[model samples]
Target chain A: MNKTINPLSRQIFIMAFSLLMVYPVLWWLGASLKSNAEMSSPNIFSKNPVWSNYIDGWFAVPNYSFTHFYLNTFTLIGGVLFTTIISCSLAAFAFARLDFPLRKFWFAILLVTLMLPGQVLTVPQYVLYNWFGWINTYLPFYVPHALGSGAGGSFFIFMLVQFMRGIPKELDDSARMDGCSWFRIYWYIMMPLTKPALVTVGIFCFLWNWDDFFGQLLYINSVDKYTINLALKLFIDTQSAMPWGQMLAMSLLSVVPAVIIFFFAQKHFVEGISAGALKG
Target chain B: MNSDITSSSTTIALSRKPKRWESPLAGYLFLMPWIVGILVLVAYPMVMSFYYSLTNYTILDTPEWVGFQNYSEILFEDDTFRQSLKVTLLFVLFAVPFKLLFALVVAMLLNKEIRGLSFYRTMIYFPSLIGGSIAISILWKNIFGKEGFINQLIGIFGFEGKSWINSPDTALATLILLVVWQFGSSMVIFLAGLKQIPLDLYEAASVDGADWFVKFRKITLPMLSPIILFNLVMQTITAFQMFTQAFIITKGGPINSTYVYVMYLYELGFARFQMGYASALAWILLLIIAIATALVFLSSRQWVFYENEGGK
Candidate 1:
C-alpha cells in the first residue's frame, strides 16, 4: 500500500488550513455587522445585519468620531512616508555612490542602530518630546523621520543603499560628466532607478505607522488629534456603554485601508520584504 | 616561477600610490540630516536613558541621583520584574519554535509546483502584514473570548469551551497562538529560501530511490539550516520585545499571566511615571536580548550551513 500523502490530500489540507487561518478576519467582517446581543450568539453572520454599525461607529463618541481619527492617521502616515522616502533616498545615495571619510564608520553605526530596539529609547524620547512642547501633536511622530530617524529609517537607508549600489557607478560618473550636479544625479538618476525600493519602503512605513499603537498612544493625548489606533482604543476606554458592535465595526474599518494597500501592492511589498532577507 | 611572480607582485603592491582623499565635505553635507538625527535622537536619548536609569526620575520632576538603586531593586526585590522576565522567556520558548514550524510547513507546501500558489501565498501572508495592529488584536480578543468563534466552533462537536483570552491559564497560550498565526513574513522568507535550493539535489535523491523523508532529512534540512537560524534569531528578538498585542488583547491580564517585559516597562514608564526604573528595565531588556542573540550566533557554527563550507 502507498503510504505517501497524495498531492490531492496535501492541496485539500492547505485549502482547509487557509480557511481556518482566514476565519478570524472573515468572522471579524461578519461580527462587525452584528448587534451587541447578537454577538454572543456564536454566529458571526446575523440573520438581519445591522448596517447602522458602520454609521453609528463612524460617530461613536460625541466630541470625536472615527473620521477625525482617520484623517489624523492619514496625515501622520503621509508625513512619515514622505519624510522617510526623501531622507532615506538621500542618505542611501550618499552611502552607496559617494566616497567619503568615515563612510564605513557611519555605515556601521547605521547598521548597529538597525538592531537597537526602538522601545529602549521610548522613555528618553518621550521626555525630549515633552521638553520641546511637541507632545499632543503629530510633530512627535513625524519629526524623527523629517530628520532621518523615524519609521525605521536606518533599515530603509540600508535597503536603498544596497539598491543604489547595484546601479552601476558608471551612471553616476556619466551623469557627473554631463555636468549633472551630485544632487541632480541623485534626484534624476538614482531616484528613478530606486523606485521599486522606495515603494517597498513606503509600504512598510505606511503599515508600521498605521499599526503603531505604542508610539502614537504615548504622544498624542488630545482626542481631536487621535489616530485610528488611538480612537479604537478609546472606544473601550472612555465609552461607559460598551457598544461592542460599533467598536468592532470601527476596528474593521480601520483595517480595510491597510488590507487594501497590501492587496494592491503585494508584489512590491513581497519584493521589498524578500529582498531584505534573500540579499542580506 | 610562482615564487618569482609572488615576489614581483609584492613589489608592485609596495610601489602602489598613496590613496587620495575623496570629497569628505560633500558626503558630510549629504549625511548631515542623519548625523544630526543620530546625535540628538539616538545618541542623546541613549545617554539620557543611562542617566535616568541611575536616577530617581519621574516625568514630573528632575532626576535626583540615586545611583544603582533601581538596578539593585530590579535584580533583587521586584516580583513583577521577575514574573515578567519568566513570562517573556516562556513566551519566546513556546512561540518561536511553533511559529517557525508552521511557517516552514506552509512555505514548503507553497513551494510545490501548484496552481494559484500566489493566491495561497497571499492568504497566508496577509495576516502577517497587519498582524501587529490594534484592530487585529481586538479581533483576536473577540474571537477567543467566552462567546468567541473558537468556542462556538468547538461547541458544534458537543464540547463546551472556556474563554481562552480571559482565563489566566490560557491567556499566554492565546497570545502565543496569535504570534504563530502571524508567521507569514517568516514563511515568505522560507519560500524564497526554498526556491534557492537546486532541484538537481532532489532529483538525484529521487533517482536513487530515496523516499521523501530521507530526501528532506538529508538534502533539505542542511540546505535550509542557515535560513532557519536567520528566522530563529529574528523571531526570538521580536518575541522578546512584543508589546502591542499583549497590551491590547489581554492587558497582561487576569493575574498578570501574560505580562511581557515590555508591557511591564510600559506600565512603569507611562502609567506609574517611574521613568527612571523603566529606563533601567529597558536597558536590562536590551542586555538580555543582546545576550540571547549572541548565544544564537555562538550555536550557529554547529548547525547553520553555508554553501561554500562544504567538507571544511
Candidate 2:
C-alpha cells in the first residue's frame, strides 16, 4: 500500500498527518491571543489580537498571582531536582559497583518499586507526612525525593545504574590505585562519566515533578503555597464568568516552561525515553 | 635506625589489613538514603495501607480493627465501587489499545526515510511531555465542551455538535481521545524499536516477493513484539490509574459515566474522609493492576518474540 503511494506522496501524507496531530496546539496558541468575543467563532486567529490577556491573567488571582505560583513551583522543583540527582546517583553507584550483603535483594526491591503504582502509597504517605507536620508544605515533595523514594525515583536510579554499569570497572580500580576514596571516585569519575544519563535523569525529574498535579494538589491546600498547577485549578474555580482569553493565556504560559525545556533538551529527552524503555 | 624502619614496615605488611576503600561500609553508606527511603516511604506505607484496609479509620479518629469489613463492603455491597471499576476497566480497554495502535502506526510512518524526520518526531512527541498538566486537562475539557472548540469546528461543516464531554455516551470516549492524543512517548519508543530491526530481514523478505502485510507480520510484528509488550504493560498500568483528565473533564459525571476508580477512591478518602474504606479501594486497585500486568506477561509467551530465543 505504501509502495503504491510512492515516496513523494508518503512525504506529503506524513507532513499532513503531523500538522493534523499538532493542529490543536497550534489552535491553542492562536486562541490565547483571542478575545472571548472571538472564541466561539472557530477561527484560530482574530483580526485584533488581545495581548493584554496574558498581562491580565498574570495578576488575575487576588492577593497572589502566577508569579507566586511560578516561584513555588520552581522552589519545589529545584529541591526535588537536587535531591533526586544526588540520592539516585549515589544509590545507582552502589548498585552498579559496590559489593555488599543483600545487594541483590535491595536491587530487586528497587526494580519492584519501579513498577509499583503511587496510588498504593498515597494514603499511608499522607498519614505519615501528616504525623511529621509536613502537610501543606513542600517538604513532602523534597524529602521523599531526597531519599530516592519520590515518583519515578527508582526508575531514575535504574537508568543511572544502567549507564554507570557501561563504564569500565577499570576506571574505579585506577582511581582506587591513586588512593581516591570511594566517594571521591564516585564524585570525580563516575558522576562526570555518567553525564549523559544524569542529564536524562534531570530532564525527566524536572518534567515529571513539574507535571505532578495530583501529588501537588493532595499536599498543597493553601493558595499561597500553590504551584502553577494548583493555581490554575483555583483560577477555574474562582472565576464565575470564565474569561476564556485570560484562562487560555495563563494555560499557554503554564506549558511554556515545559515546552522550552523540551525544545532545548529535545535530543536528550528522546534518548532518555528510548534508553529507559529499551534497556528495561 | 634503618633496620628499625624496615622491621616496622615488615610488621605492617604482615598484618595485611584491608584498605578503607575496599570495606563494605562504603557500599552501605552510599545506599543509606535509598534504604531509609524504601523503609519509610514505600515499605512502611505499603504495610500500613494493607493494615488500614482491614480497619475502619477516618483520619480524625483512631483506626479500629474491623477485620476485612472494608474489603467485604467494597467487594460485595458498594455499588459505586463496582461502577467505578467498570468505568475504569472500560476506559483502560478503549484507551490503551487505541493509544498503542495509534503510536505504532505513526511510528511506522516516521520510520521510513523521510525529510524532516526529526522535526516530525519532535512535533509529534512534544505533547506527551506536558500532557499530564492541569493546563492540558483544562484545555481538553473546554475543547470538547458544548460551545467549545470542537463543536465550533464541527459547526463549520454543518454537523450538529453536542456537549461531547457532558454527555454520557461520548464523555469517556472524549477522555480516551485525549489520552490517545498524547501518544508521542509510546510512538518514540516504537520508533526506536522499529529502528532496531535489521534491514537485511526486510530485504530478504522483499526478495521472497512477500507483500507489505506479510512482511509486517513475519518481520516487524515478531521483532517488535517485545516492545509491544513493553508499551502494552506500561500503558495499561497508566490507563488503570487515569485521574487528572477524568477529574477535570467530566468530574466522573453525566450521571457517573466517567467516574473512574481513582476518582471514586479520591472521593472516598479525601471528600468523605473514609480513609479506611479508601485504603481498601486502593489495595483492590493494586491487585487489579498486578493481575492485569501479570496476565499480559503470561500471554506474551505465545506472542512476544525474544530474538535470543532463536524461534525455539
Best by DockQ: 1
RMSD of each candidate relative to the true structure: 2.7, 5.4
Return the top candidate by lDDT: 2
Evaluated at residue A158, the lDDT of candidate 2 is 94
TM-score (all chains, Cα) for each model:
0.95, 0.95
Residue by residue across A1-280, what tens digits does model 2's lDDT show? 3243478988998889889888888888887888887888778888899999999999999998899999999999999999999999999999999987778899899989989988889899999999999999999999999999999899999999999999999999998898999999999999999998999999999999888878988899999899998999889889999887888889889999888989899889878888877988
lDDT of 1 by residue, B1-312 (tens): 999999999888877955454657778878999999999999999999999999999899899999999999999999999999999999999999999999998998888877778888888987897888888888888889888888888998999899999888999999999999999999998988999999999889878888888888888888988889889988998899999989989999879999999999999999999999999999999999999999999998887778886822
Cα RMSD of predicted structure 1: 2.7
Deviating ranges (above 4 Å) for candidate 2: A1-5, B1-23
lDDT of each: 0.88, 0.90
Give lDDT: candidate 2, residue A78. Answer: 98
